[model samples]
Target: MRTEAIEAWTQLYAAVGLLAVICASCAALKTIVELRGGTVAFPHATWTQKFLWFPRLWLRFQLAYMSGFPCIMGIALLYAHYIGFAAFNPS
Candidate 1:
């Protein structure tokens, strides 16, 4: 039972760590592209225009991403705890 809980926790952390790495990579790529004066493509031209015109649009994106990361992490943590508990105390 203890081993099963440990395994579940390990898997959960591994998945969350992978997600964090992917998010960081995306942010870094965006910064690199912006620094090179390349436009980030949007599905719509209007959205692209807004991003180009606003200047702070990228900053907003980063801010939103940063805020969202914690919320997602929290949810993942809760879910992992629930699953781990369930495994140890199956009804």
Candidate 2:
């Protein structure tokens, strides 16, 4: 039972991390485009419409290049590690 629980948690973490990384990666791409003098459309006026990506995902919003990729990667990694800790360790 314990092993099964850990296995399930590992899978869940992998899925969540993969999704977050993918989204952040997409945002990173947009960040690059913006950096290169290309404009990425916001496409929304209302705050909710703009942040419709996933709850309050900061990656859904534009961040400065200096803090964008690094911050995104850091957050993704942080969650992955935390989940890993919680998911493993036989109890």
Best by TM-score: 1
User: Could you tell me which 10 consecutive residues in candidate 1 have the lowest summed lDDT?
Assistant: 35-44
Best candidate per lDDT, number? 1
lDDT of 1 by residue, 1-91 (tens): 5777667767777878777777777776666666567564433367767656546656745864585597568768787777756764423
Stretches of candidate 2 off by over 4 Å are 40-91
Please give the lDDT score for candidate 2.
Answer: 0.59
TM-score of every prediction relative to native: 0.51, 0.40
Candidate 1 Cα misplacement greater than 4 A, ranges = 38-85, 88-91
- Candidate 2 structure quality by residue, lDDT tens digits, 1-91: 4985678577666765676667667776766676466464444578777776343334534443334556556765676575666555567
Candidate 2 to native Cα RMSD, angstroms = 10.6
lDDT of 1 at 84: 59
